[model samples]
Target: MPLKQFISGVAEFSANEVLQLDSEYQTYLQPLSGKSLALTLLPIEQTIQLQFTDSRIDILLPNNRADDVGSEIGSEVDSDCHLTIQLSALSQLRDTNQLTTLIKQDKLDIKGDLSVAQHLSALVNGLDLDLTEILTNKIGDVPAHSIMGTASAVVNYVKYVKQHFDITLGEALIEEKQLVASPLALANFSDEVTDTRYWCDRLAARLAILEKKQLAGDK
Candidate 1:
């Protein structure tokens, strides 16, 4: 698939899932609710707006892009806090879900309403939870524990093999093909050869002069 097709405008994706995700968030955050804030998210290029209230969360997408303008909040809205982050950063958050980590690394930029931004990061951090705990409710505790352990081991084994292959390929290329070398070592070898030739020429000339002097003295 093309890069654009594969990464189909984050704003559009979020707008579709906003209802479901907001419902889950609301269950957790029952108290202290209102039009909490109007959030503006700029994923490097595309812009998305999120408005939080006691009732529900509204998602706003771009107007120019026909593809992303389907939801009610797709229209223009006032931004309470503006955040700029790369599309790749959002992808990373899918696994880690620690917005503070990105903020610490300077991968995410926030402006306007510092408190609101910090709250948003906390909301995102809440996404990271133990899957085993949720699964145990549906299945038995022992089964859920076994499943998670097996899944984790599989992921680790795949990662280990990938890492081992990368290191092996790099070493093979350097040692067998001689693809990499030190420029300083080559220069040192050249300089030593030149010095040896100069010394040998000087010694040969001195020996010739001594032999000629001895011949003259004998005559």
Candidate 2:
């Protein structure tokens, strides 16, 4: 059927996309040049071994490619340095420096080898993707610059609005607290009201007695 053919073509296209990994990683080959390290993600228990050589880097996928470990299998590739980290830790890292800081603070755990951690940090830190250059290539320099400037302005405006909003909310909270009576204050107010009512009732009774006495004297 035509629908089946379309699905098959999509699968074939994805297969070709996976083959393009070499070209994509070639740009990063310079910094990751001499470092060979293995990173193991716990819980799911997957190992990603990156071996850098004279020519290109080889990535050993744990379950799928055990044979690639070859002569280095249990020696350099497997036993060199297994950096164990949680998947959650990876998500929390905003940049390369955050990982190193967390590690130094003892918030992030690095076991097996210290060299692995150092190599990983250096490799990540050395990576620099210049979005300005990429944007310039896609669009003209002037237009790209204009777009970036507008984006920066919008971000600054949003931050300004958020800051004002937080200040206004804090002021409103203080005003609300001042307007509302505390339990102790309310109790004191209630006692005063009861005392006023009692005094008023006593005054009324004394006035009635005085009026009766005046009537009797008139008779």
Candidate 3:
């Protein structure tokens, strides 16, 4: 739950920072101001809600801060977008912007409208936030930028390593250990099933024709 807590805190902070920015920046998030998004993380079995208000984005963790906002766990409140994904794959989705590709690869599953996710992406990308200026009062501009850069690099490297590790482990299991079927094997099996069904359907149709002709001859 520490990661969930950190994510919530970051959302809150980002919302506050966006509010303090100029009106032009607010326009980027206007489309999402009244919508809600839910992210269901795999393995952890947690759903985090991002409730968008006109002022800020409230990140609600079930049985946690959600109670503060009068939200219930598994509530009837509909989300504009609900994404079910691996917790580890979140950064890849963000950094790569390959939502459709990920879905095709079975790396992500989405419910509800995709336009909502697009709007959310727009909100993130359109905001050219300069955090250095915000922190310059407390620390010098050079130090602020340096810290932000180092943090960004560290995050990217960690994500890169995690992604590669998952891929390597999957390969080892499928190719080396024979513990799992590869994607190509799955596709081939699907094709074989389809072909078998086609032949069965054709045979059934021919049998029906023969039965009808025999009845006609008997009559």
Candidate 4:
């Protein structure tokens, strides 16, 4: 299937899953009733709008032209708030209550109603779905436990490898290749420049004073 279709399917499935808990956790979403929010994923330029009711949410892909995946956020959005985020940061959003932290880390950007965004974050963090229990019911308990264990291990391993790779690449650029300056080196160089400028200004002032004294003597 096409990328857009796949994204739409995922969004729909996610919305349905969220709504399944609405009956029990509708209080979290009550503040967002009759409101809408737009989330735009960067680099892919896909925008998904979430229309919230008291107990349901409808996810939609607005201005989904595949050819314009590089275009800006669609102007057709009528959401109470809009959130723009990097695609890579979606995983970090699992900690939905840390909206301020994510913004500080340059992982998310928000516009429009901040209260709506906060309420949305509260709703996401409030979800208490027992995925392990669901899996145990669908399959056997042993299989469910094994699958969850394997999934968790794989995720941890991937995170470790990614961290290692980033550190290695940064070291190569800063130390091995000398393409990027080390922080200490940069700071020292900045201090040297500042000192040179200060001395130059002082020397200029002294020369002016000397010239004035020489003129006074000649008079």
Candidate 5:
């Protein structure tokens, strides 16, 4: 299924059913107080605007940019940080099942401020949104295969992000991999990699020039 369609369907279902279980879903929003997240879906070239507040949740989807999708879900808690997620690889995450497979394959590429990403992952992992039950009741048929197979994969991704990035949902940083907390470090590494590639090309060009010069001298 296309990512946009899948996300739209999920959003529709979530809007109706999630509101009914407001108290239950509120737990997931606890980490968002005063936080903002920019979620970019690379494949679809779409972005979702999210603002996490203690009392209200505002999700702006591509189709409805002027309106918020889920706005009546939470209460004012505490404002602390911001997170940005570039879903450059796992655009399939729009489907819960595909998200599981991508995570298992280690194909999801998430880059951002490590601390913020980690915290967001933790919040998502801690959510008790029993999607199976919700879908079964809401859609009248649960996507059992997709949900069960992908649940652990999704959880593992969160764990990996938390551990590797040093940030958890509650603003807690894991002790290990703290070095990744600096986004500049990642940028520097990327720059070095790019530089190495440039130098390799330069050497190849130099070798070609020397070979041509030798051929000319022989002539």
Candidate 6:
């Protein structure tokens, strides 16, 4: 099948599903006041760009495979550096929802800003697309590497922070690792991981708040 046809089919499949997903996302972010998240689904292997402005978020959905979807959120008065998530291997993960999940989980290599990647990761996970079921029905047996590799990457990132920055951000970061690795692990752990969805929501909220505060302080 042609890429366009495939993408169209995927979009059709996700259209109704995305509404529920977005609602779940909003519910997950209920604690965050005055913040909005925009999600854009595009053709395979397209770049997902993000910009920060004042008061509103601008999300440009990719109209064609070659086109890029640029998204930005913040205030118009003062903005932070624009972040971009380029999907170089989008086509590879396009046909298989499992592969997409693997990429989001960091099982596949993501070459870009890690912080932005993490934020995108959280955003993708928050989507209520029922990817798990899709993967199970289409592609039986989830790859163990998908979760393990992501867990390892998070672990390494945490270690790097501790060794270089010497700033303690607490267990939330670690809990993120666990949640991505095995969301069920959250139930086992008494820490912040207990609320896997909340962890991602809080991370995005705190990051936005911190970014806004830093911009303010700079002014």
lDDT of 4 by residue, 1-219 (tens): 568768777887877675574346688878999999998898788788888888777778887454765655666677889888989988876576676788999879988998887788888777777777778877989999999999999999999999999999999999999999999999999999999999999999999999999999999
RMSD of each: 12.4, 17.9, 9.2, 6.3, 18.2, 22.9
Off by over 4 Å in 3: 1-11, 18-23, 63-77, 95-97, 131-219
Off by over 4 Å in 4: 1-9, 18-23, 38-48, 61-118, 211-219
Q: Per-residue lDDT tens digits of candidate 2, residues 1-219?
A: 655356545654553343233334344445446666676665555556666643454665544344554533223335355665666676654465676776776545555656655654554455454556556777979988998889889999999999999877766655565655656778999999999999999999999999999999999
Overall lDDT per candidate, in order of appearance = 0.62, 0.62, 0.79, 0.83, 0.56, 0.46
TM-score of each: 0.51, 0.42, 0.51, 0.58, 0.33, 0.23
| Candidate 6 structure quality by residue, lDDT tens digits, 41-144 | 23233332333222222333333322334432211212122222234444443334454565576545433333443444454556666555544555564654
The candidate maximizing lDDT is 4
lDDT of 1: 0.62
Q: Which residue pairs does candidate 4 place in steric collision?
A: none
Q: List where candidate 6 sits over 4 angstroms from the true fold.
A: 1-19, 27-58, 61-87, 91-116, 130-219
Model 1 TM-score? 0.51
Kindly report the root-mean-square deviation of model 1 from the true structure over all alpha carbons.
12.4
Clashes of 3: 0
Q: Positional deviation of 12 in candidate 1, in angstroms? A: 8.3
Please tell me which model should have the higher lDDT, number 2 or number 3. Answer: 3
Tens digits of per-residue lDDT for model 5 on 28-70?
Answer: 5565567766555544445565566654555555343334565
Residue 135: error of model 2 in Å? 0.8
Model 2 collision count: 0
Judge candidate 5 at residue 4 and give its lDDT: 66
